[model samples]
Target chain A: MDSTYINEIRRQFPILNQQVYGKPLVYLDNAATTQKPLCVIDRERDYYLHENCNIHRGVHYLSQMATEAYENARRTVAAFIHAAAPHDIVFTRGTTESLNLLASSLGQLLIEENDKVLISAMEHHSNLVPWQQMLRQKKGQLLVCPMDDNGVLDLQRYETLLDEKPRIVSIAHISNTLGTINPIKEMIGMAHKHGIPVIVDGAQSIAHHYIDVQSLDCDFFVFSGHKMYAPMGIGGLYGKSDWLEKMPPYQFGGEMVDQVSFEATTFNKLPFKFEAGTPNVGAALGLESAVRFIESLDRNQIEAYESALLQRAVEQLSEIEGLRFIGQAAKRSGLVSFVIDGIHPYDLGTIIDKMGVAVRTGHHCAEPVMTRFGIPGTVRASFALYNTMEEVDVFVKAVKKAAAMLR
Target chain B: MTIKEIQDAIVEDFSMFDDWMDRYAMLIEIGKECPLIDDKYRDDKHLINGCQSRVWLSAEMKDGKVYFAADSDAVITKGIIYLLIKVFSGQTPSDILDSDLGFLDKIGLKEHLSPTRSNGLLSMLKQMMLYAEAFKLQEDKK
Candidate 1:
């Protein structure tokens, strides 16, 4: 891609053309949540301004149009993830809710006393806590597959942990704090061999690269739209037909009911069975727009550009004295997390913010990952497609100054 | 000077620094000047939770005035607590209770503190007020 293409992409995101603390903003907090582009924002606004209505129930024109747009958004997500059918997709509040729905429903379906649920140590709290609570309720064991010193999942230990025959295996596609991209294909295959289903938390991975649920062959996959430049409060969960067929509906309400009688109520079909009550129609349209935006940009080019940006960030940030990166995984994604000696991540983060560089401090919602590494937290700089090398230079200079001040 | 006068003085001092870096350096110096908490009072009972960094606060009443001592693991948090102690310590319980603490906003200190750190600052302030309220109750009983 040329500078013109990159600049055009940057122009679409209006939030980037601003200042913070009297300095030009260099937003490197994409891993937390991405800023929306004009198209996604406008699409959501258009839904409210022109097409606003409760979906799936009304007889009026606005309702029909909204239902079509809402269902079409499901199809867009289904196509984006290459699911077998739009019926395989379920609308969710976000990745956290999706994981909770799965854990609760799947736990009820699969987990019994003494059954095990295996998760890696690198998972965010969203992916970890539900299983822990579910297993505790079921009197089942929640086994943690340890990660190596460098933040790579210890496959040897995972293989051993699988010997216990966990009811299901859940893992992250990418570590939010460490940026370790797990070998999902091989891990899924390994779990499948043991007759266990796997759920891949793609909250971090979905924004960075292509994901095909059918290709990955995992029983389920979950992601948040806000992490990918869509509006917040919209996400999707893609479950294989077999799992969705077997599992009970996560929530019971209107539209998820096939027939409501005074005596007994039968539930609705596949995707609707999970989504309860009135959905986020505007957010769904925004998510569809975000998906269209990604499709407009070549996935291969986005991946390559992000990889190069990460390289530049790593190279530049490594030059700072006493700065040590948390995760030194061989394969990583579009983020770099580090801690400087004699400076708290909070202090470093505060100083950097004053210079108008937006980075995430603290545990990044993966307190377990920090516990595994025996550190309080790390300062993370996550890059998105709009990020330029010039912004990285500003971040590096600001970080160097921050380190000097704190130390 | 009164507690409000001291806070006004601190706010005026912070106003001299146009940049955050200079303000932070001055704040760190204020933290360095904070009197250390006694080892006996450094136990978990006196320790304030909810702080991203560990903080221990000790309060004592002598001649109807409340004296406070504090320590923190983080420099910035320590500095914030030190600033808080400067305004609250050596004041009567009633005087401490009536304090508005608007100087924090005037200096932009509250906004400058990160979310977690600001929560910690609030936790510290609450503990101080609780101490003041408790001393006030003791005096009432007497």
Candidate 2:
């Protein structure tokens, strides 16, 4: 918990450096929301100070400049996911809002009574609940595709459900709780064969690895900016241009309107139709900065370094008596999750936090996945770019000490 | 109920549920306070099926106060409903709409909710607001 790299990154985040419970903070809650880099923090401050103006409608220079900067962020985001067109990237409040937008609009058009909506057990609630709410409204059946012992999607069971060919199948690109990187390319291909549109909840994966929309061919994809070193309340929904063109506007308000009459109002085209309000201009700029930051860093180097770190973690954690790693997927993105026998996750998390090593506790918005494992929750340590082997060692020692006290 | 009574209830009653052990006990007690939902309400029509724990919510209006009764198969979630009810219950429509429970972050435990559970809590709050909106409409018509 006292490692220099940890201390360095800790210093970078003014929020992270502050004492919690009379101890220096150890933040492992990156899976929930990441601490911003100084660059990201500065960019947000700089935006409000310099580039603060309402976009699209302003005739003045600042408004036009503001509009350009915002849309330029849109292009950077589109390029990040390898989307075909920039307009395919519709800015949203966050992954939750993005998913709900899809669920409410396309869900209304597609879902029906007893029509099955398929999702894997590993989905974050953000990915699952929108479909469930939509299915409930439509009197549709919600079906979960089972996972095997390793928490990988059970292809056999997936095929079984694929026979019903759910109207919509939503899956996470990576499991936030288990760190299971789902085999989404194959899953998407199989789903498309059955005419089921797949939405990849890329909230956890986007920061860790590369995502090419054309290669994966998922109909809808979502991720939050806050998870990827950007500010919160900004995310994007990537739907095929054609589908977005057809789907109804999620919220009725300014900017989405084409023409407003007393009788009926026409909506704007693909993205503006979905982006209903004033939008997060500052956060979007910060997200664009995040995209640039990730792009500028050597991604392959980061991946290799992260993989080695994860491998070392697995080896070390497995050595702890009664410690079991969930979903050792052999393919995870910059993360590892595990549980210690006879230690409640909450207790483990609190004790570790006291020693200044932060890790996520409880069901990680994927309680069904926790239920599948027959555990209340796990202590999840998710990694990011700034993390180092020394920090991991500190975390490991703290976990070992915590286990000795509790277990 | 006066705002001061509510302010006091929130300041005191919810603070005691901070420890998960105490939290669970408090939740179980809240379950005791909540009337048992009818079997008819357990169907897909009323069942909030997304929750990892089974949750049933039923609302009724007797006089002016809108009574909310919720039970969750998960013990902790039922307690979550209790915390929710403390803010939500016995409030006027406009007041309920305007109130920001952001102070929950300062107290902590709202983050204890898994993201899905957080959403379920949010949906429950939204549903409560919707209920208030509907009640206001009905009152206007009368």
Candidate 3:
């Protein structure tokens, strides 16, 4: 909310204070992965330097400290997303691994022959493929809820699909490619009407807006830390206590097992049961630092700034000749995707990179969305809290110039 | 002229442009002049598979010399293909096979091209070299 505070936040990210290709770096690829602040990086490094020990096992001082730090990171994640209890949070590799864990465990527990799992067409492949594999394994049906022309998921059709008695309704909280803020709360409510549990893929949404799992009442919420300025290879999945109690453990290993006999073994309780083996302890601390970083700023202020930036970018880019936006959803967050006439997205991406404005140009792991639009890919410029209007101007100019050259 | 001489000349031509924008313009101009592939050969069988853009390439071997004709949906990729064909066409299969084609890096084209386009360029080179290799094998049999 305070311009001075926002500027101070920008100064904390050291990577932003550099040049690429002889131009000041205008990084617009935050949707793929956000750059870490020095605090987060230093926190991880500090953990390795001082608190480097395996957690929840040894009675030694360092082990207890490490165990406390790791569990505290889980609590941090739980608090960030407004989960009711910290025990509901299970740490995994990232959004992809978290989703895989959910699909594997939940599929085994819930899915049966002829049972249907419904997902939106706008889903990132991570959300879609696991369900497809689950359906294939269980001999169940995988149903798609189609998105409208503006890339909004059709809620009417989704409601109708619920009549088919889908076992689960999994969808993205915000589409990574289109930046569409899906009406997930409403969708979850509708799915609950049919007693079908909903899994929210919050990988893209978690960085941009607040998430309250208790209010959404979704069965499971999954997201990656890297997408939100934390270290890679660490993420969290929050499952309701009832589901956590019922579903089986995703992996069997040292920490997750209560007692391992030659014949059988009983798993540990809520979180540790899901997080098997030696977890990425340092990265977990880094995620805790990232959570702290997000808390240090005003969430409403950050959201408003990013939303205004996206709006200004869309307006400025609309002035360029023959530029067509892919997603015109009424509610969008943090990004924009577009294709220009006669200029390949890849070509534009290359030139933009040369101009030192980094943007992602490809299917963005959402090939179904691209196929729906009948294009190879798109040039996506995703913003973070650190981005400025000056940088947006440079990006628009660079895109326009690139389009002209390609033409 | 020799293939190396032709490549060197093209690289020198690119050196005149200090700015990336001008270099890209030159490439686009070269793409405009690239020899069009035969419509019959524009089908999937003759199309280069790995390009981000749709690039159709066809080759003919007559009297042990390789001739390439290609077209691309994207101008920049078309220009890249033009450079390859300029160096490789009207040469013996052996001459085509032995050439290193470092001219791309010399002209700063490799760094300028996106990863996908660079892969496309490599695929185009592989396809041309493959044709040359095929022609060489046929000559051996004869």
Candidate 4:
């Protein structure tokens, strides 16, 4: 709650202390990917330095050790998300890969002709495109759950959309672009009554909030480790164990096989069936360390801090002439996406970068959202556990300076 | 590999019939760096859909190799096409057909371009690849 507490947290991220464009960096792109905590970096380094070896099918001690660690990492991630079983969790490359795996493996199995796949209008392209492809391939329909004027999903209309009894309703638990945390638990509950399976894209929410798959009753949940202060190229998909057991293997070869013969090949079971080839072991290890780091912090306090920061950010940014919030929902995580008056977001981004502030400037991989808003793109500042009010002040000053230059 | 080689190709070959500034600017920025398409060809038919900028691309084959000419209204967007041209232009139809244009990350301009910019580039590249394959198919028929 104190300013000093945030500064202390900032000290954990080594990169934040550096100079960019002759000014101290103010990183607010945590929604895209949070900076790696020192523990995660060290854990990853320690793995490569001390215990680097190919996991599975190795008789050597190092191999056994590496395998133990990697599987332990899997267990940690599974426990973090409160999955019923570790076997239900499939380690993936990232959220995109996880979503695509679900679409390719599960969506293909479930979605037949005329079966509707429902998604929110505020979904990131990763959540949108793969299901869209499935819809195109299977002659199915992709129905968008409508949003209110404030960019929040319309619950009444959502119930109306659910009247169609969609085969699958995949929605982001928290919107990456807008930072609106959907009423996922309620949505999932409603979908279950209709016997519709739901996939929760937890890419934005998993890092900031507590996620209990059992409590939410989501059929499938996916998130990227990188977004949660782990290394890139590693994420996970948590599915109900029974559903995972029933789905067909996504990619064949390497670890995901029971036996291989010239005549016939038998696929492996559950998580292994989806995960093929050499996994990103080092990154997975880093994710385990990231979970450990999260456990050390008062997650509730961090969320409160970030929320307070978001309030400050919105209040400060709105004070600037011609600036407008794109997604001002009643509830949000730590983000404020806006477009400056008459100035292109790219130009705004370029100038803000000049002031040593790092914020995402583009469609945020949700062009449909941009199209919905009738804007080219938005400049978004997403807060993390470490972001301070001082840095936010700096960001505010820089945005004002950038806007002045344009004026 | 070098700027000189690219510039030489740009100067010595000018029959592509596109403008020097308005058309060539966008292509060179995205790094496709192709020659220009004539104004006569710049109709709605040639317009690249889904691009933030207006883009036009035309392709022709001569002596079993494919030549592409592209133009865009956005400055950096042209650089994308120019980069593609540097890698893809003047290649044989068979070679173009065999190559994987998905080496986008290796070329290292991916993170620089926004998602929409990259998507536009993808749509344009996909169309060009389709055109090249069509040429390859035609040549095979011959």
Candidate 5:
């Protein structure tokens, strides 16, 4: 991508034009959460200013408008991921909540004593803890798919683990800490051969690449919108209708129930049965606007631009003495995690922040990955569509300066 | 010296630095010189849990005054802990408990004290106070 196009894209995010600690802010924390664009902000504000009312069962015009907007957001999410039906998309607070919902609902439906759930070593805690808790409750076992030192998942070992006949396979589409892009399409195929279901944690991958649930043929996929320039507290889960129909409701409340009698209550249909509350109508609208913003751009160009940013970071940062990258996967996303010989990640991060660079430091909620690598933590710099090559240069300079000070 | 006198001296020392680089450089020097906790107490038992870095703190009562030894994986955090120890060590439990840590802000290192920073300075200070309170309770029992 050209500089002019990149600059135009940067202009849409109003937060980018600011200074931090007497320096222009260089935000490389997109893996944590992305800065919102003006359109997404406006869409959310417009909902509250114009159509602020309860969704679903309401007779008033404002209520109907709000309900239409919320449902439309659901449909937009469905189309974004290429789900078979709008009902397959369930609105969630974010990826963590979506995974927890699956763990709870699916555990009740599918998990039995001695059953197994397989997950990759590179999964973030959101994907790891939920399944561990679920399996513990069901008296089932949790099998881990190992990764090599380069952070690539071992396909041979993963294939071998599949012979254990795990009830489900939960894996990250892209690792938040390592940035390894797991071959979930092939992993799903292998799991399906053994009649095992798979859940793809697309929290990191959804913003970086296009997703087609039908093509992947995975049982379920989950992602958060905030990482893609939407407001927080809004995300989605796309599950196959066959599985969703059989699963129980995740929460019990007003919207999820059809009829609440003295003795028992009948739950609502596919998406509603999972929602269970008044819902975040404004954030849902913001998420839809973010999806539209991404669709408006040339996705292929954006992907290529981000990959270049990651490459630039790797090449430049590798020149620094004593700095070692943690994850060097053959197939990776637009992030890099590394540690210096003697300097701790927290110390480096603190100094880097003084230079107006925002990067994530520490285990990134992937303590298992840290243990696997035999390190305390790593400093991760993640790139996004709006991140510029110039910003990457600034980040590299900041890291170099911080390393000098620490050394 | 009393805790107040020591904190005042630290504030005066830090006042010489005009920018963050000098301030952090001094902190890094202090970290290098900071007394480390014995390896025996450096396990999970003495570990301060909240900070992004691993911090080990141990305290003992000598002649009715508390002395502390602490260590951290991060140099900046260790330096901050050294500062905390300088202020509170060799002080009576009551004096340590009664002391205020507003000197952290006066030294322009207030950001480290923020809970969001996750550097464990705040947790370290709290742990020190708890150690003093425990010693006081034991004295009361005696």
Candidate 6:
């Protein structure tokens, strides 16, 4: 992308222009959560200012407008991922809630004693712990597909695990810590051959890559809006109507019910059955605005630019003595995780932050990935479309200075 | 010296640092001098929660005063723990319990004590206070 185009993109995010600690801010923690664009912020503000009302239950004018906007947001999410229908999308709190809803509802619908659920070693805790809890409750087994030392998933081993006939397979589309993008299309195909359904944890990949659920043929995909420049508390779960029809309601209350009687109550159909509480209408509108913003851009160019940024970060950070990258995966995405020989990630991250650079320093909520690398934690600098080449240089300079001090 | 005297001395020591790097450098030096917890007490039983880094703290009452020993894998955290131990250790239980650690903010390390930092320094302070409270109860019963 050209400098003018990039500058235009950066202008949409007002948070990027400020100074932090007497220096220009360099935000490299995109994997944790992305800063919002002005469009998304204004969209949310417009909702609360003009159209805020309880949705789906009212026949009044304001409620009708709110309901239409909320459903349109649903349609926006569906089209963004190319789902079969808008009803295939379920509004959730975020990827964590989406996964928990699946693990609970799917666990009830499918899991029995001794049934197995397969997940890879690179899953964030959101994907990992829900299944663990579900399986433990059902007296079922959770099988883990291991990865190589470089954070690449072993597809042959994954295929072998599929041979065990797991009831369900959930995998990250891209690792949050390692940035390894799994080949989910092929992985889904392998799982389908075994008659097991797959769920794609798209929390890390949704913003960075093109997503088409029908082409991937996965039964379900989950993602969070906050990681994609939208407001937090609004995300999406896209499930094939077939499985959604069979599964029970994840939560029961106002909108999720068709009828309520003392004797028996019938649940609502498709998406509403999954969303129980009064929904986050404003945040959903913001999510729609975020999708519109992405649609307005040349996504392929943005992806390529982000890839170049990651490459530049890796190249520059590698020059520091004793700084070894944790995940050297062949196919990686918008982040790099590394650690220096003598300096702790926490210490390095603390010092780096003082220089007005923000990087995540921890297990990145994937403690198993840390154990696999035999390290306590790593310092991660993740990129977004708004992030620039200049920011990457500033980040590298900050790390170099911090490394010098820590060493 | 009393706990207040020790805290004032720490503030005086940190006052020489013109910038954060110098402050952190001095903290790193202090970390090397931390009174480390014994290996036996460094297990998960003594591990402080709510910290991004693991911190092990153990306290005991001896000769009518409370003493603290702690260790952490992270050096900056260790340095902060060293400062805490310097103020509270060898002090009477009531004095340890009554002491306010406002000096942390005065030293420009206030951010580390914020709950959001998750450095466990706040949790460590709470743990120290809890030990003091427990020791005070024991002394009252005696």
TM-score per candidate: 0.97, 0.74, 0.95, 0.78, 0.99, 0.98
* Top candidate when judged by TM-score against the true structure: 5
lDDT of 4 by residue, A1-407 (tens): 98787777778899988997467888999998899989999999999999999898799999999999999998999999999988889999999999999898887688889988899999999999999998899999989998876889998989989998788899998888888889999999999998899999999988889999999899999999999999999999999998898888888889999999999999988778888999999999999999999988889999888899899989888788888899988889878899877666755675577678999877888989998998878889999888888888989988887676555
Cα lDDT over the full model 3: 0.89
- Model 2 residue B116 lDDT? 49
TM-score for candidate 1, please give it: 0.97
**What digit string (tens of lDDT, one per residue) describes model 1 on residues A207-307?**
99899888899899999999999999999999998889889988889799999989999998888888889999999999999999999997899899999
TM-score for the A-chain in each candidate structure: 0.99, 0.95, 0.99, 0.98, 0.99, 0.99
The all-Cα superposition gives candidate 4 an RMSD in Å to the true structure of: 8.1
On DockQ, the stronger of 2 and 3 is 3
Per-prediction DockQ: 0.48, 0.05, 0.50, 0.06, 0.79, 0.66
| TM-score of chain B taken alone, every candidate | 0.90, 0.71, 0.90, 0.67, 0.94, 0.95
Residue-wise C-alpha lDDT for candidate 5, range A127-195, written one tens digit per residue: 999999888988999999999999999999999999998988999999999999999999999999999
Regions more than 4 Å wrong, model 1: B32-35, B39-43, B112-119
Per-residue alpha-carbon lDDT of model 3 for A1-407, expressed as tens digits?
55677678889999999999789999999999999999999999999899999999999999999999998988888998899899999989999998999889999999999999999999999999999998998899999999988999999999899999999889999999999999999999999998999999999999889999999999999999999999999998999999998999988897899998899999898878998899999999999999999998888989999998899999999999899999999999999999998788877887788899999987898988999999988999999999988899999999988887777
Error of 2 at A80 (Å): 1.2
Clashing pairs in 5: none
Give i-RMS (Å) per prediction.
Answer: 1.8, 6.7, 2.0, 6.0, 1.0, 1.2
Candidate 6 lDDT tens digits, B15-65 = 998888899999987886665788899888999965368888999999999
Ranking by lDDT: 5, 6, 1, 3, 4, 2
Off by over 4 Å in 6: B33-35
Model 2 chain A is weakest, by summed lDDT over 10 consecutive residues, at A1-10
> How well does candidate 2 score on lDDT at residue A186?
95
Model number with the top DockQ? 5
Report the Cα lDDT for residue A296, model 6.
94
Which residue pairs collide in model 3, if any?
A: none
Indicate the residue-level lDDT of A297 in model 2: 68
Show the lowest summed lDDT stretch of 10 residues, model 6 chain A. Answer: A398-407
